[model samples]
Target: MPLEEIQHWTWVFGRAQQMMLDYSLREIEKARTNDPETPMSGFAAAGGAMLKAQTDFWSDSLKLWQRFLMPEEAPSEARALSEEIGRRADRDKRFSAPAWRDSPLFDLVRQSYLLVSDHLLKGVDAIDGLDARQKERIRFATRGFVDAMSPSNFPLSNPVVIEKTLETRGENLLKGLDHLLSDLGRGQLTHTDSGAFEVGRNVAVTPGKVIKRTPLYELIHYQPTTPQLMRTPLVIFPPWINRYYILDLNPEKSFIRWAVSQGLSVFIVSWKSADAGMKDVTWDDYILRGQIDAIDTVRDLLGVDAVHAIGYCVAGTTLAATLALLAARGEADKVRSATFFTAQVDFADAGELTLFVDDDQLSVIDALANDGFLDGRYMAATFNLLRSRDLIWNYVQNNYLLGQDYAPFDLLYWNGDTTNLPALWHRSYLTDLYRDNKLVQPGALSVDGTPIDLSLVKTPAYIQAGREDHIAPLQSVWKLTEHFAGPMRFLLAGSGHIAGVVNPPTSGKYQYWSHEGTAATLSEFLEKAVETKGSWWPDWIRWIEALDDTRVAARAARMPGKGRLKALEDAPGSYVRAR
Candidate 1:
């Protein structure tokens, strides 16, 4: 702590304490004046009651602190002692009064004290909050703090306490502080091994021969072991929200490999991570320019009139938009059929995420977009908060108190991968699609003066929903089936978002259920279908294979010439990098 920072913090702490004292005294006076004869059961408790509680909490906190910072003492002994002191304190009634039951002065003063306490505590540089097992481990590790006079972890770890200290400064102050902590945590977790990187690395392990496309991005083409190939090739459109390699992860889990093995030519789109140059790239540009370019490149190389397309998550939205845009321009003949993996086109019921995307929030986002791109850390933090009890709290307990090294879990590592959204596009997306619910309704959204109509899309569609997807709730994604006029099949998977999509047959525990005869919401489908244990991927492949044409296509006389690489050595491409 620098002298300047210490001084600033002290000043804030003093001011907050003063506010708390003033509020407490004022409330006390009000109580006396309002009902002079009333028994002071609540607000008339002894002054030392608050003091005693504070003292007790501090005593326990100090003991815990010593266990961590002290030398020459065994951690187990220290922890046991801390627990004993906590038990003793817990037995005392004086310190156990609920906030509502406490005297007005005590309640107000304590809360004010909390404002100062929080800042002082966070200044210690420790993560706050812990899961059950983690809290148990901390208690065990800091037993020595059981009877210490000085507190360890005495102060609240929440950042809100500091914000209360700076409330007069402005709400923006709190927002900025929150953004700082969020960015710090995100940067640490997403240092490098993000989901995007993992996907790229794992794709290289597919069973068939792999040929490098753009070395910079590790974009490659795969040839199946089987000689027979389907008439029309398959091109996968992955959500830019994550890397494209999720479809081609490990050998057993590889959807792309499975497709190729089923005798189909498969092409996967590997997106490039945008930089300052891509700041102005609009949603329309992605579909019209990016997707169209990839399709043209594929067609020119393969000489295929139409390609089977699969889109997942946000990419499904892009694919939907591309189909709509293409249809409006009479280019629908290029698409044979489409499959959506938990993609949402209608945001009418976008799950718990909707609560945070009102008009007021969009305005703030609009201002943030002035820099052209919205920081990926901001989005990552928001998602982490959604599961705060699990992600944030668990990390704090494991890493800080126990001094344990973070164990690597591929799912969690991938979860930590954060990506940025262009501010303009993010703002427009939230306001137009989520807040307004426009795409499904006619004349709601106009791209380049042309309206987007979902009913106009007549491509055969297969839409699958996971039972538990926090990002795109099953109900919202299922709404797409209602809007599409083409023949559509709806399937339900047993797991959550990423797990459900990356379903490998070997997992063996997965179950798929469907309504069969009726076309309704996912909930309705699950209600009528039988539960069977098996991977949805194999089932999906089977359905897709049945729909595919059987004629085998020999190797073409000409193949798509390799494109020039931006970097001869891999720098950073879309799949191998984080947002």
Candidate 2:
């Protein structure tokens, strides 16, 4: 059955069952009333509560409609629109409702949309003291309803779609159907034109070799582009939820290539795409075999006591936790310095991602563990919902409504490259870090039998947060400074989660903000910050260089198998190529 059909039937059956239960409870209550000594049973009380809630809903709805009907008491938004329509014969061309002023029928349709949208938002707000998750659910549902009702979604109502149909003589609609069928066959929504780019040849094309491999990861040591080099090597820990190639997408935007050109030894931890066999993998396994092992391999290859470590997004949080674990084991000095790129260690205000992460929602996700690993498609869908208008509906219109092909873009290609998450690790992340907010709480979480304490991390830190990031909000990322005992610097980047971090100096695209001193709050830091032109990459490089004094004439680049660990494959390693 189609999902929608199943849902409709489910609702029908649920309502029937509730009605039957209510009838039974009322009969039981009547019998109990005959015996005055008998008290109210649990079932009767539950039915009474349900009845009261239903009554309240109808009462409130009636009051709302009554107020809406009264022109004197009608919402200001509705009144303003009515006044505007009377003044102007033509509607704003920029809006989807251009036909609103064309006829009374169209005007009524537009006004009804506005009035319902206003009421929906006001109604959600009027609910007394809703918890975060409850409020988020309401907002998410409202967005879905509002998007569905958009005039542009319908062929007859949408002026632009109608004009396109006329221009193409209905060819566009046919093409759109084909696009929709293709995506349906793939069992996932198409986000990018996958054919426009190839992995090793164009995307993660930086010249590099995989020197070491674990069941969980492949560590790639990028070739140096300069003759002279800094003594301390830089190892990057990218989020395992997606492929590591995000940092190395294309020549111009590649962070790995830029660091290599700057005479710094670069190594990246390329995580294996998880599957059924990897279902049993634990969070500690990621810390141990994934990151700690990569650190050990890099240190051994470079023959250095410590190296500069960098983590992006989720990897940054894991990296901080790993440092804490190392400190607990008296091995804190192994990392010379730490840099976090749009990663958050604290989850108190983890942004929109946290909305779908409460106990009930997590239970539903946990139920998906029957497949061993959570499907990457599921993760992608959740993220798309965060910015549905752009990520979901935009594609829907192009691929289905308008029959347009996806544009070829490196960043979009990277976005479409999805990876699965091991069930165990996914569950732990949801329950511990997100649900409990345990990382910042000492002894709340343990890795390898040692309790995590973020304050134990004494290594100098550099943290970057994207101003427009919805995944890891800037405020949440800024909380890292409070937990770290070491000297910390925070950078506010201009773009979002992916673009902000991938920004290269050559693009001359976005500006970054840097404060002279760490402030008690993120707001204070932003207020006192000095805006600087260009990418934040140069500032990061300067910070890393300042921490390390030993610079010598660079030696020849280390090839795979030449290092302590033997080379298994070429760049863009086999794990990343996994289906």
Ten-residue segment with the worst summed lDDT in candidate 1? 146-155
lDDT of 1 by residue, 186-235 (tens): 56433222434454464435532222333112334455456667777777
Query: Candidate 1: lDDT over CA atoms?
Result: 0.59
Q: How does each model score on TM-score? A: 0.64, 0.83
lDDT of 2: 0.79
Residue 281's C-alpha lDDT in candidate 2? 96
**Candidate 2: minimum summed lDDT over ten consecutive residues — where?**
59-68
**Candidate 2, 199-309: lDDT as tens digits:** 998899998788877789888988777767888888999999989999999999999999988888889999988889998999899898888888888888778899899
Using TM-score as the measure, the top candidate is 2
